[model samples]
Target: MFIIELTYKVPATEIDAAMAGHVAFLEKYYHSGHFLASGRKEPRDGGLIFARATSKGEIEKIISQDPFSINGLASYRIIEFKATKKIKAFDDFAGDEI
Candidate 1:
């Protein structure tokens, strides 16, 4: 699992302008099962995403497709982790170990 944090690099207006494309990018990943959950951060400075992937490189490739990334509107911080415990609802997405 990975925690993908997006921090705005440009102004909010710039991020807003790319919202539609950004959403489309998110939808694509979500539909493909790479993304589990995502939403804006409090104070609206950036966003957060929970995703599943085999490697950080895979996540980086996915991130490269984001409009925010394409337009250089945001910076990404990808944190990889091993899930020791999770709800039953997340079983499928949580990988085999936990």
Candidate 2:
């Protein structure tokens, strides 16, 4: 399993449109069993998403469809890593416990 952290630099003009699609994406991923948790950062700096996927490619596909990427509302950085272990709260999430 892998964890993907996405940070966006949103432009002022596209904020509402971007957020609408962003929330829609979150709901889609959650129902599809890919998204674990997602939300905007405090002070609205950007957003954070925790997802479980088999490969970086899979995660990339997900991000590529985001409103931030689609409408050019923001940009993102993806960090890929193998999860060695999980403690307490994270471990309690049933889908990707590795």
Candidate 3:
């Protein structure tokens, strides 16, 4: 699994302008099984994406295509982790490793 953190580089206005396209990008990945969950941050400065990928390189390739990144609206920080534990109700989120 990977946690993708996006920190806005441009103004909120610019971010909003790109919101539709950004969401479309996310939707495509969701259908392809690349992204699991995503949402805006507490302060609304940026956003976060929870995803499952075969490797860091694969994740990098997908993220590079996000509208936010392509438009220079935000910067991405990708973190990969193992799910050693999780609630049974959400076990599926941890993928087959659990």
Candidate 4:
């Protein structure tokens, strides 16, 4: 399994557009079992998404196609890491083994 930390640089104008498509994209991934959870940062800064993917490249591709990216509402920084450990709530889904 992989953990991706995405930092979005929110731009004012595209907020609504980004949000409109965000839900749709999230639903698509969630039903497909890729997205685990997601939310915006405090102060409504950026957002984060925890996903399970086959490869780092796949994650990048997924993010690149997100509404934020497509509409240029936000820029993103992606950090890909191996899941070495996890706390109770997510323990069942954590690991490099998956």
Candidate with the greatest TM-score versus the true structure: 1
Each candidate's TM vs. the true structure?
A: 0.93, 0.74, 0.90, 0.75
Candidate 1: which stretches are off by over 4 Å?
Answer: 96-98
Q: Is candidate 1 or candidate 4 better by lDDT?
A: 1
Worst 10 residues of 3 by lDDT: 89-98
lDDT of predicted model 1? 0.91
Candidate No. with top lDDT: 1
Instruction: Give, for candidate 1, the lowest lDDT window spanning 10 residues.
Output: 89-98
Q: Tens digits of per-residue lDDT for model 2 on 20-73? A: 777887898889777777767776767777777767788889889887778766
CA lDDT scores, all candidates in order: 0.91, 0.70, 0.87, 0.70
Superposition-based RMSD of candidate 4 using all C-alpha atoms, in angstroms: 2.7
Which stretches in model 3 have alpha-carbon errors above 4 Å?
89-91, 96-98
Pairs that clash in candidate 2: none
lDDT score of residue 66 within candidate 4? 80
User: Predictions ranked by TM-score, top down?
Assistant: 1, 3, 4, 2
Model 2 superposed RMSD (Cα): 3.0
| CA displacement after TM-score superposition, residue 48 of candidate 1 (Å) | 0.4
For candidate 2, which ten residues in a row score worst on lDDT? Answer: 89-98
